[model samples]
Target: MFKIIDLNTLGLGQEFPENIYFVLRGWMDSNNIIIKGDPNVIIDTSYCKSEKETESIFSFCGMKPDDLDMIVNTHNHADHTGGNNKLQLLSGAKIAMHEYDAHYVNLWDESGLNLDFSDWELPKFSVDNILTDGDILSFPPFDFKVIHSPGHSGGNIVLYDSKYEPLLSGETILNGDFGSVHCFREGNRALFDLRDSIKRLAQLPIRLILPAHGGPITNPQKCIDDCLRRINILIKEPIKMGYHFIRRWFIHAVLIRGEMEREKLFSHVSEIENFYAINKRYIKINNKDLFNEIVDDFIERGVLVDRDNRLSVINP
Candidate 1:
């Protein structure tokens, strides 16, 4: 079971055992944690929806935004890096992200309907450090190596904290479902990269898997294997309708298609002519399940809405 932690203005340190606090977003329950170390470190920041809301996460960590010494981003998605500028200004902490994903973090292009960038301007921050696979951070009371898991994004980094045998995985592994791999549609190579990255981590002696979204897992290898199987299946099936259809469907049917009763949406889905072609193609290969699964995952994240039987995207 999951629990929610509320915060005061300055912060409620020691509320979480060992000074570890989960900063969760109420929308979808997507959470990031603050590890109070020699100098406290934040795993990731919530979407840059607004400063007032985002900064509250710091208080939950038992510290203010300015108290953080380091801010680590697992990838470049806006949700993970949105509050970066605000946090930096308050905490004066150095921001770190995988070198490969730094460009997206630095410059967010709006051509794509990626909602992570909606309602907020890209914050500026210096990459005080870079993390690569096998690189270990030995900050007192916590020591972990960086595992480069590139399927979700080219530069995705999962911090393996040995002290607790836990991983601070940004978007790599989330409660048995995988992170959004379609974000890197420009290169199919990233899909394969993600497979390899998961396989590599499966070999490690990991215990708990912590993610920026969803719940955590006590069994790392099993979760990795499940994600691997899903990726493998997607590869063999081939997205027959092409990437454009898949992207549009995600944005429309899943995001903008206002909420209704779940049963109503499912029953009447066949009537939506705009998605007929893609749906038919997926149905042929039994890939329709995958499409629905992704939609359900987003719904769980509060990124997708299902009201009554209608569906739509939640306005950030």
Candidate 2:
């Protein structure tokens, strides 16, 4: 089930004024920030399942559907932009996102990203504006500087405000851990880009971080630093990172079903479109080649045994 956290209970204090309302929804606690001002703006709508909840939130803030002027999507992920069509239709708001992600948002299934958007009921929507790095989006009371931060997903962006010091960090950086970049796409899991994006964000004098998931982060610098440290470790120990990724899903699959046929496991993965669980890490396989390689590595490590076309967890 999902829940909502108003501005007052978020513990942001006076730093975040009454104008900003963070709507937390879904199992992952995806956040949709509603800024109350002239030409009200909404950052990242949650999944379609949370549409009603999102509407109620707007009403609670004394806002009608037509009150919203703009809808900005941080990325093309289904969870982030699932409610775009609904909100846009209701509010007649102009939807804006990076040009690179614009097509993906419209033709998600055909993007070959290996993601399952069936459950989310993602609707096709056209991008009203194409945003680029260094573009300043001026919507009364706030001026957001778009910072192109890829790696988690191609075309991912972070909105920064110099004076306000609140970074609308999409999935680039979270409170404790960073967003997952191991998905199947050309530039989705570019490790070098992820490192560069994090480094770039670390240089900013950010006071608060309003991420897509989790609560608002007051210690922005430390969070970025911690993420950088982890990324550095992954860069140095590539094999270890691969093993870590494989083990997480391997254990999850075995624990849930006790034993799984090799073909059945592969079929299940195709259906879900990723290895990670809902609301958990976002690591995913981009293709069958990588999937087989990971499985072979697990077998060689004696963590999993493949016998009679079935894969099972090795007893300790």
Candidate 3:
């Protein structure tokens, strides 16, 4: 009977009880769920920052270090599986995850380089068993089916409880917005496929969603619509303008101001990248051309006025 500790913001850290414990805010904290069963089960060990944090979590739950049964990962992202090694060691639990992310888990060094690797150092860890879609993990009295909803990542899987009719889809169907599909290195098809996957989930009777980011939504239909809207923008708006057009739009949207100087606009560009979580390196490699094209389109559309190196938004 543990109570939830609110982190104030809806961005990070929070806990909910019901055999399910969402470590971060918005059901996103290194998700750690406890399944009610013969021996009890725990799902998705969180990005354990330190042994002390892990111990504190267990202590708050009135659980001992050696009490965890089964630890599973929704995918191979560091935030989702950062504490695999520590949790397993403390609880003597078996680590489970999609086979596709096995390499990421096993090779994860404490460099914060998994999903949040570029910005944060991810602790190294590994998985013991490979899981797949449609596979049911039984804890007796309750069982969850793995829904292969790959889009955020190749190995992404959402756990569904037939009894509760709820989904523990880490980062698959976030509330307030959809999950970010910015893994350009993984290929654009992955992002496009995500659109299809969410549409399929929209048909389900899921009442509650446990997403990796943003708040959990009781209204599955609304959540699905929100996801569709965000994704459809990628398909409809981005495509209409082409990759280049979108890039320029981002630049003008972020960097340009009426009659702003080049240096000021350039600084704004950096701010835009941060706003969209766009990496400078990635923009140079994959999106530079597309970004420039988008800028040109913005110019043609009268959305922006680019003079020499100076730029500013035009009245829409």
Candidate 4:
């Protein structure tokens, strides 16, 4: 069962203008922000992972899954939107995401939806309503204006509350870390978009940031500044960024799939297309070389407990 806690207790000391609840999720899934009101809205379903977990999703936020009026996805990433299909089926809730991102979901494009990247059993889910920039969605006591923040992915969005000064930042801006920027197709357009999106949010009157990945961010401005500095580093040093990206994402892959064959990473990342682009355009190294580089980086980071040939986040 998912435990729902008050936002204040979850580290946000100040009370918001509405009844907002937070759910802490495992590393395999994203955290959730629930708005309990006339029409209950769950910001993200976290990651349903498998169909078996869907059976008990109704227990979230003290309401049955079917009672949920809306399932708002912060982005199209697998961790963020994997549960869309099952949740919608239970609640018949109107699923909403940025208009730009809706293309992947509506068309069931595995690559665009990031479904190809994850080994999870992510079912294709349709978007009931397309959320465009400036769209205002009200869930009773509070209303949010949609901000199309397309740096993390082409369709990632930030929900802004002008009156309350809080915004749902998704994976774009986190406590100390931002989303992983890979050298995918379009070259470095995603990188540029991330910079622009952060700059745009910096201009907003934001007091708090509710992100999809990390826990809630109270000091959004400082976080945005840190994101800009990190972006500069990423842009200036794609080689190092590439190495780090592989390391972090590999940690994720190992965490979810569990102790994958070390060599399998080459084939797995090949499916993402960006791996080739990273090597050809920026890193200028073969997959094996890059893999070795990332392994060294991971060891230095101490997140790698198992120094064996296989990659694992836990000690075996």
How well does candidate 2 score on lDDT at residue 109?
A: 51
Selected candidate, larger TM-score, 1 vs 4: 4
Model 2 misplaced stretches (Cα beyond 4 Å): 1-14, 106-109, 112-120, 239-267, 270-273, 276-316
Cα-based RMSD of candidate 3: 9.4
Q: Residue by residue across 1-316, what tens digits does model 3's lDDT show?
A: 1234332323323322344444542122354565544455566655445445655666555677578777777777655665677777777788888877665556653222334322233455667878877899886655789887777667788888767666887767777455445444345686677887887777777767776654456677877887778777766644331342224235424432346654665455444432233433333334434445555677898867878876666533
Deviation in Å, model 3, residue 223 alpha carbon: 0.8
Pairs with steric clashes in candidate 4? none
Overall lDDT per candidate, in order of appearance = 0.62, 0.71, 0.59, 0.73
Task: State which candidate, 1 or 4, has the greater lDDT.
Answer: 4
Residue 23 displacement (Å), model 4: 1.9
Q: Indicate the TM-score of model 3.
A: 0.67
Work out how many backbone clashes candidate 2 has: 1
Output the lDDT of residue 274, model 2: 40
Q: Where does model 4 exceed 4 Å of error?
A: 1-5, 10-14, 50-60, 117-121, 263-276
List model 2 lDDT by residue over 1-316, tens digit each. 4444554554655555668777655432258888888879889987666677777778767788779999999987767877888989998999999978876665655453224522234667778889999999886567889999987777889999887778999888887666665534444346678889989988898878888987778888789888888877766766445544445534544544557787777666545534433213333345455557757877888877899878877741
Q: Runs in model 1 with CA error above 4 Å?
A: 1-17, 26-30, 107-121, 124-126, 183-186, 240-316
CA RMSD of all predictions: 7.4, 7.3, 9.4, 2.9
Give per-residue lDDT, candidate 1, residue 30: 39
The RMSD (Cα, Å) of candidate 1 is 7.4
Deviation (Å) of 23 in candidate 2: 2.2
Weakest lDDT window of 10 consecutive positions for candidate 2: 112-121
Number of clashing residue pairs in every model?
Answer: 17, 1, 26, 0
